[model samples]
Structure formats: C-alpha cells, structure tokens
Target: MEPSSSPPAITEPAAAGSGEPLAHRRLVFGIVAIALLMASIDQTIVATALNAIRGDLKAELTWSGWTITVYALGQIIVMPLAGRLGDQFGRKKIFLGAAALFTVASLCCSLADNIYLLVVFRAFQAIGGGAFMPTATGIVAEQFGRDRDRAIGMFTSIFPIGGIIGPIIGGIIVTYWSWREIFVVNIPIGLLLIVLGLRFIPSSVPKATSRIDGTGAFLLAVTMLFGMYGISSLGSAGAEPTDPLFIVAMLIALVLGFLFVRHANRYATPFIPISLLRGRGFGAMNTINFLFGAAMLGFGALVPLYAESRYGIPPLQAGTLLTARAVGMICVAGLAVFALRRTGYRAPMIGGFVLVAGGMTLMSLAPHGLTPYAWLAMAAGITGIGMGLSIPASNNASLQLAPDQISAIAGLRGMFRQSGGIVAVSVTTAILNHATDAGTTQAHSFVVFAAILLLMIPITFLVPDHRGTW
Candidate 1:
C-alpha cells in the first residue's frame, strides 16, 4: 500500500474546462459504475434461475446453493490479495486483468454442459469479479482525495445501484432467452469496460515495502472457509452445531485460523495490515459494517425467493420487485453527496439505518394474498436509502482513517462486508429452511428479514458524526 503522504495521482485528465466538472466526474463515475454493475449483476443473474440450474444440473438443493456460495467464497479468498496486487503492480493492470478473466468466465459459464463445469467457471468468474470492487474503490480514493466524502458517496452507490437493476435485467435475459443468457450478457459489457478502463484507470506504485504473506493469506482463507461452514451449519438445528465430528473439525480450523491471523500480524505481510485495526474509528465502522453486511446479504437473496415462491410470480416479475431496491439506491445515491454536505455523514447514517429497520418492519406485516408490489416497492426503496447512506459513510470513514494505506483499509472493509454477506446468506438459508413448511417459506423469510433489521439499530450508533479528511 502507498503511504498517506503520497498516493497515486488520477491519470485521467478532466475534460478540460468543459465548463462542467460535475459532468466530467460523472463520466468517470459512470465507467466505475458500469464495472461494478457487471459484477453485481452476475451475483444474482443465476438467482432467478436457481431452480432451472438445479434441474438442468441434476444437483440437489445443497449443491445448487454452491452456485452462489462458491462465487462468494472465491471472492473472499481473492479480495485481500487484490488490494496488494493493485498497489504493487498497478490498479489498471489488475482491474483490466480481472475484467478480462470475468468476461471469459462468463462466456464459459454460458456454454457449460454440466453443473460441475458451471461451478468451476463461476469460481473463475469470482476470482475475476473480486478484483473489481476493491480496485474501483481504490480508484475513487486515488482520484477523489480532495472530495473524499462525496467520492465515497458516489463510489458506494455503484454496487447497490447495480444490484437493484441486476435482477430485473437478469430476469429479462432468463425469461426471454434462457438461464445461460444471464452469463452471456456480460460479454459486451465486459469488453467495453476493458477498453474504457485502459484509457482511464491510472497506473500506481506502492509506497510501502512489504513481502506478500502467502502463509498468512493461506491461513485467513482457511479461517473464513471454516467460519462460513460453521455459519452455514447454524442455519439448521438438523445440521447440529456440536456434532462431535463437525465440532472437532471446526475446532481444528478455528485454532489454525486464529494462529494464522496472529502470525500474519506479527510475521507475514498480511493482506490487511494489523496496524490499521488500531484506528478506533475505522475498526468500529468495519464492525458495524459486518453486521450490516449480514443483514443486507440475507435480505438480498431472500427477498427474491419470497416474491417468486410465495406469489407464484414469474422470474421477470420477481426481478422487477428486486429492481425497485436498486432504483431506490440510485435515487438516494444521487442525494448522498448533497446529504453529506448538509449532515456531515452522522445524521444520515442514523437515518439510513432507521429507514432500513422501519422498512423491514413494514415488510413483516405484509398480508398474505395481498399484492406484494406496493409493500415490496416501499421496502426496497427504503432499504436502498439505508444502504446508500451507510455504505458511503462507512467506506469514507475507513478510507480516511487510513489515508496512507487505502488498499489495506479498503481490503479489510471489503472482507468484513463480503464475509458478512456470506454469513447472512448462510444463516438466512438455514432459517428459511427451518421456518418454512411446504406452504409458508415465503412468509418465514420475511420474518427472518424483520428480525435481522431489528438487530441493526444499536450498531448504527457506533459510527461517529463528525467529518474530517479521513
């Protein structure tokens, strides 16, 4: 990671006195937004088609879940390394490389004749996809150092905005074409990003000298996998947490994982520098983010399931409901810069969570046989506001706290956020599995989302209200 005293300069020139700085900045944001959109869309492209994937692949429900799990796992495994790679090599090289890999993998995914091949390609796609989120963020930090808060507001909006629209777009592709078309859709977008990225993304060199921590990286990966497995297991009582055999295995993994983190802090050049964790503001923000991540991730997946399974809605309709969330995100995202200017981040942060909690509560009351369109639209939009505010605030806080090491701070935030998603999905899946009879899974899912939303309130206060360069 580069030192705070001197970070990478934005290589792309402003559309010189185009008499519109906002428009020029928006162009850059547009490019980053599109890259993020590609990645976000892929997460759920296979979502509406989960059943089709299961039927075509002849896999059981458990294995079908891996289509999503493997991709997230791949992302978790690669996320930390991306920051280091971006810093050491250059953001443009890593960004373009990841984009290219993601593009090719998408093509492979479309053509896979079997589930095994599809899963493999998905993992490959994730490795590539993982590079994108962090790199795009690092670019924002690099380019918008002067306007840190607004930069984060814009940067954070990209994914949720993408996520909001992805399901709708994905549904269209699946409905009009086939499930495989979801993967195929990325080809043109990916190609364009690669071209745009090369022209715009600046090259950078790391200011700090440190060796890659292969040992620590390996251990962190193991720890996350084990932790995720434990989380996945907790999703069901039938999947006993203390089965002697599973407990023993988990213990071993936990022990090694702990040792790995410790070792990394002391010996290895860890993917996340332990030194950064010492920043009280940054650390607290990240902890809060992890909780937020868990809730948001669970809801992200479970919402679609509810619309499809409970309402007997088709894939496209289900997707439209999900797209509403993104629309809310995009709308709130535009407001974020202005909001930050007025509120200094703290008030909006609290308000965002409040909206989320309130929205989730409203969703819990949705009556059966009622058209979910109205409820879903409100819930999705409100949740987007909560998400839009929280993400930008938390991201800016963490990055500012560690201005010298944007890569490392951004990497850690990404890890916590991604891991939160992984755990949330695992737990939600487990809860949905347990709560639902054949008849009421959809309702049960909402109840779970309500519970998660209720849990986010206290955590929101941990964030500080003041604005600084950090």
Candidate 2:
C-alpha cells in the first residue's frame, strides 16, 4: 500500500490564546497533571478495598465485583464521547464540569449505604474521571504545541506514578479510617482542581463541527455492558456458561457490536474512526494494549484478594504487597524509554509481553504450594516492568503509524485498554466464583492471564520496528 499523506497540522484553538507565557504554560501543565493523577489513582485504589466493601455492604462477591466492572465500563463508554464533546464544546468547560461531577460523585460514593448505590455512584465518578483524561491530554497538547513531546512525557508519567502510590495510600486510609475515606479523599482534591482549573485553564473554541454519533455510542455501550455482564455471570455460583440468559446477553452483545462496526464505517465522524483501525500498525498496537491491559490490571485486581485469602494478610498488608508491581512499572518506565531509543519498538514490545507472561506463570504456581512472599513480589515486579516497557513502545508505535489521527488513536487506545480491564475483572471473578478451591481457581486464572500475555508477544512482532522519536 502507498504511504498515506501526512495529516494537516493541528492548529491550536484560537480562543484559547496560544503562545502563552512560559510560566502560564507551566501552571496549566501542573493543573492537567493534577487532574490526570487523581483520575489514574482512582482506577487502582479500590482493588485492595474490595473485601472491605463487600463485608461492610453485606454484598455477595459477584455483585461486589461490579464495583470495579461498572467503573471501567463507565470509562470505556465515556472516553470517546468525552473527546468529541470537548472538541464540540470547550476543553475548559468539559474539564471543569467533569471535575465538579467527579467531586459530587465522590461525596455520594462516600455516603452510599449499599453496594448497589455505591456501584451506581462509582459509575458517575468514572464518567467524570474518564472525561478528564483525554480532555487534559488535549489541553496539554494545545498549550504546549511545539514542545508537546516533553509535555506529553511529563503528562503520561502521572499514570504510573498514580498507580504506584494508589495502593499504599488506599491501604493507609483503610487501615486508619474506612474505605469510605477513599472516595471522600477525592472530594477535596477534585474541588481544588476545579478551582485551579477555572483560574488557570484556558477555554478552547470548538474545533470540529461533526455531529455526535449517538446511535453508535449507545450501541457500543450496550455491547460492552451486556458482554461483560454475560461473562461475569458465567462465574456466578449455580450459574453455567450455557445458561439461556448468559447466552442471550452474549448474543445481544455480539449483534450490537456488529451493528456498531457497520455504523462506524458509515458514519462521517465515528466514535472510533474505522480508518485508524485499518492503518498498518495501529490495530496491532491496540490489540497488544488490550491483552496487556487485561493481564496486567486483571492480575493487579486479583493479587490483593489472593494474598488475603492465602496468607490471611490484612487489607493494609495486601495493599502494600500490591505496590511491588507498581515499583516495577515506575522503575522500568524510564528505562523502557531509553531502551526504546536503543533497540527500537519491537524488542521492548515483544520483550515486555514475554516478561509479563513469565510473571503470570510464576504467579499461577503460587496456588499449588507455599511460595515465599518475596517470590510473589518479585513476580509482580517483573509483570510491572513488562507493562512499563511495552505500553510506551506500543503507544509510540501507534503514533508513528497514525500521527495524523493522534487524538482519535489515543482515545481508542484508552477505550481498548479499559475494555480489556472490564473483561479481565469479570472473567477472573467468574472463574473464582465457579471454582471449588480458591487457590486452584486463582492459579488457573493466572495461567489464563499468562496465556493471554503469551499470545500478545507474537502480535507485537507485527508492529513495525519504527526507530523514530515521537
């Protein structure tokens, strides 16, 4: 195929008053980072708190799993919509509104008396948090137009940093206070972001005139929600994969999913542009991202439960143990950037998946017999390193392949990764529910995760070994 023409240069929103002073740019970057950090940390903070929530709410394990599933679903649903909304409205308007919504939702979560209420509120919180991410990315890209590469580097680092610290913070809070504090803590931060954002964040004019693809969005949301619900139901006690309801939901999801693809292809402005997916390297990178997200976040979600169940570790200790993975990710992320510079994208991409697969294999062995805590932590760390290595490389590769559609590509990447998270949490929970033995069930689940990661390794080879810098 002939090389596609370079996309027209992205112009900054005229209303935002580009070419701001250096100090002003730094202030905006800080605001964006703060917003991004809060959203990122929220993703993992609840992983360690699931047990506490279940006990407090008198909820079944399967239902409690919805707390994570619903939040991710909300994110997956809102990411693309949020980007388009931001483009249609204004970044500052959407960011502040989302921040405010998040603050209110956090308060509601803290006050929720039942698991059902908590899940509903958590979804709202996710809407706000999810919308903040892409909009913040846009803000940074616009504010630091020429120097966006450096700005983006700083912006992206917040995710790993937030992930690294989230469990520790959640543990300390849950230990001293209650899990409610986890949501409560966001209130103050969210409010501060709103206040700061109002003062520092510039408003951008609508850059695009495309209509929101409401039908496509609704169809896609139904597809994911039903698909996940069906998968999770398979693991419920007394439930069988062949159950009529489960089969029906899956069928519905499949049908809607097919319709969504057809709709996207025909729509003038799709939530996920079909052309981007058709690009040479873009689809492969996203596939790797999807699998990587499933393995990485799925394992992270289950580890605390594994530790608590096997070792009778307290929530605080379990949370601390979870940090080993983050340590690996944070430590390796910088090194991965350098490694990418030396070996190009292919080595890091393939090597990262290999490490993750290896780590999952080690983790799967834990259920059969006694394994040292240090050994488990080492495995977690290795998985984290793999995540640190591969994620950036894949992201860089996607940009290299579709630099013209960077915004759309980034949105799709987030959507696919969160979609993986939804599947991982649901499937792992289902496996645990159906198994008679916790150890064996978890072991089996890790093995499945390992297999998924292993499959991603070869797919990474399909990505062009692009040596160019972003």
Candidate 3:
C-alpha cells in the first residue's frame, strides 16, 4: 500500500444522547468508574506487595519484575484493539465482558502457585483491565454529549485516586493477611460492578465495523519483546554492552521496529496510527510523556522495593512511601486539572517536572538528620507535587491538536508512556539481579533518572503552549 497524507479516520459514533436522565447517566458512569478504580489500583497495588509475592514464590528479581512488565505489555497492546472492538461491537457488551474477564482473572491470579503462573494469569487480567478505559470512555462520551469533556475529565480524575490509595490498601492487606488477599479483595468488587453494569449500562449500537491490523500488531509485539530481552541480558554482571547476544537482540528489535513504523505509516488502518506519532505538536508531547513515564510511573513502581531494600523498612511502611507521593499528587493534580485551561500547558508541566526531579534527588540522598522514613516521605511528597502539577496538562496537551481522534490519541499516548515503563522496569530488575547492594544501586539509578528529567525541561517549550480556556 502507498503511504497516505493523513491517518484513516477514527470511527466516532454520532454524539447523540439517548434521552437518559442526568441521574441515570451518572449511575452508569459510577458503574464504569468502579471498574476503572479496580484496574487502576491493580497497577500499583502490586508494587507494595511484590516483595512478599517474590519471597513466597521464590522467584528471581528479573522474573518477578515481569509481574509489572507483563501487565503493562498487555495493556498497551490491547488498548487500541479494545477501542475498535467496542465501536465495532457494542460498548455495553464489551464493558461487561471486560469486567467479567478481569474478575475471573483475579481469581486465577489468587490461585497461582508460582510466579510464572501469576505472570501468565496477570497478562489475561491486563487485557480485561486495558479494555475498561476505551469501552467506558465510549459509554460516557455517549452519555453526556456537550458536557463530555467535563464528564471525561471527571472520569479521568479517578485514576489518581487509585494511584493514591492502591499502595496503602495493598500494604494493609499484606500486613494483616497474605499477599493473596490483594487478589481476593477484587473478586467481590468485580462481581458488584458486573451486576451493577448489567442493570444500568445503556445499550449503544455498534458504531462501525472494521478489521484490526494484524501485521502491525505482530511487528510491534516482537519489537518490544526483543528490546526487553536484550536489556535484561545486557544488565547482567558479566554481560557487556558489546555482548553478541545483546547486540543481536537489539538489532532484531530495531529492524522489527522499523518495519512496524513502515506498516503504521502505510497501512490503511495500522495498529498504531502514524498521524498520532508524526502529527504536528505530537512529537514533542509523545517524547516528553515517554520520559515522564520512565521517571514517574516506571521508577515510581520500584519505590516500595527501594524502601524495603535500601532502608530495611518493613513492607507496610515502605508501602506508605508511595502513599506519600500520591498524597502530594492528589493535592496538586486536582488543582492542576482545574487550572490547565487558565495557566496553559507549559506552567504546570514545567513546574511538575522540576518538583519531580528535585524530589527524586532528595530520595536518593541519605536521611541526613531526619529518620529515613520521614526523609523519604518528605522527598516523595515533593515528587508527588511535581507529578500532580504536570500530569493533567501532559494528558491534555496533544488532545487539543487533534480532538476528533480522541480515542486514537489517548491510546497512543498511553502506549508511549507504558512502553517507556516496560523498558525501565525490565532494565532495573535485570540490574538488580546482579547488584551486590540492591539498595545503593537503586538509589543511584534514581539520581540518573533525575538527571534525565532535567534534560526534558527544555522540550516542554515545543509542547502546545496555549491555554484551553478559548
């Protein structure tokens, strides 16, 4: 196929409100919100409990790390597909299916006898989890027509709540009960969402019918696999960057990545739209978001482990470290979300990154005069404030450039950050496997991450600088 000047049109259903009452629409929104919160919590909840899982399963650092890696991998891959599937089929059917799938997968996860089993089950859980957003977004978009932006914003805000509460809840479960209790807790909640959804979710007709780009999906998958494996191998103690195996793995990833890009640019309906990647203003936002994902979401995943490993803090306490960050994030993110239309994208984002970088630098340092817990909490809070300030703008920056393709833009933006996260955690775990002092190594890694965040500041100038109050 020849390359096109623009991406294939995203299949946007008519923006019709089906005469649903405002109270009714909110009920539907709440049902989906519960599932979203469940999925969101699952993302970070495991971080606090991971060490316990590893010790119980007797898994290696790199292998156990795949626990986080696999979930992200599944989500990035499934998101675009889910969006199209929801539009092709009915959103109601897709929403209920995803919820049921997540519930069943949670049960399977709770029963896993080993880390390998858990990873496999976790991938299925991720597929269900990944489907929730696009399908739910479709449901909400139809529910509130002119007010969709506000509804969506309100919906999106639920994510940080999950981030804030996930670790603390996980910490509590693991502290009071077995780590399996984390999964056990989901079973009841998931069931409730499914029943509530069936009773309340409006039935929307399939808006479009189309096929997914199998070739593009395949190439993207293999490319990430090769890159992840190469990094994992090279991070070993005796393995040099020049190692033949590492070089081969990376080369394969590069070649495959090139093919994936070509397919994306040229295909009629590529798995990932080329326009989203190369569109004006898109390049800057995607790049900065990738770095943001690596610095905040990716490194943030390891904070509990870092606390437990470096400071010899207990699981319950280490878990609170993330809570501290979330506390800061919630405090600022709510304000930033409301402020974005007034301040423009640049202010909150630049300020957020500065706080993030400074906070991370503080975390890397010793307690100095304060207790390790107090010192780390203060640093984490500082970092959280940075995240809170920036995240809302980071989310909205590119969307303004191409509002029609909201689903595609949102999926791709998430994919970049998640892709960055997969690589970061993969490499970090690989290095930790060989480190003589895991804590010191992890601390030093944060410093390096902070330095990298500093370099990202100048690029924000390229990001969309206008306020959205227009």
For every model shown, the clashing-pair count is: 4, 1, 0
By TM-score, the best candidate is 2
Model 3, position 29: C-alpha lDDT score: 80
lDDT per residue (tens digit) for residues 345-375 in model 1: 6666667777777666666565556577677
Clashes of 3: 0
- Per-candidate TM vs. native? 0.84, 0.85, 0.83
lDDT over C-alpha atoms for residue 424 of model 2: 84
Candidate 3: tens digits of C-alpha lDDT, residues 281-386: 8988889878887788777878888999998999778877877887788777777777776888888888888889999999999888999999999999999889
Error of 3 at 409 (Å): 2.0
Tens digit of per-residue lDDT, candidate 2, span 1-470: 11143322234544124433233567788887888899888987887688899999999887787787778778887876776677666677888999999999999999999999999999999999888777876777666655454455444457878877877788788889999999999999998998888776766666666777788778877887788778766656777778898999999999998999999999888766776665557778778778877887778878878877766777666666567887787777776665565677888778888898888788767444445576678788888888777766776676556543445556667877877866787667766766677766887788888888878877877788865444
Per-candidate RMSD vs. true structure?
5.4, 6.2, 6.9
Model 2 CA deviation exceeding 4 Å by range: 1-25, 47-64, 146-150, 153-156, 175-179, 308-315, 338-343, 366-371
User: Which candidate do you rate higher for lDDT, 1 or 2?
Assistant: 2
Runs off by more than 4 Å, candidate 1:
1-28, 233-238, 243-249, 307-319, 366-372, 436-464, 468-470
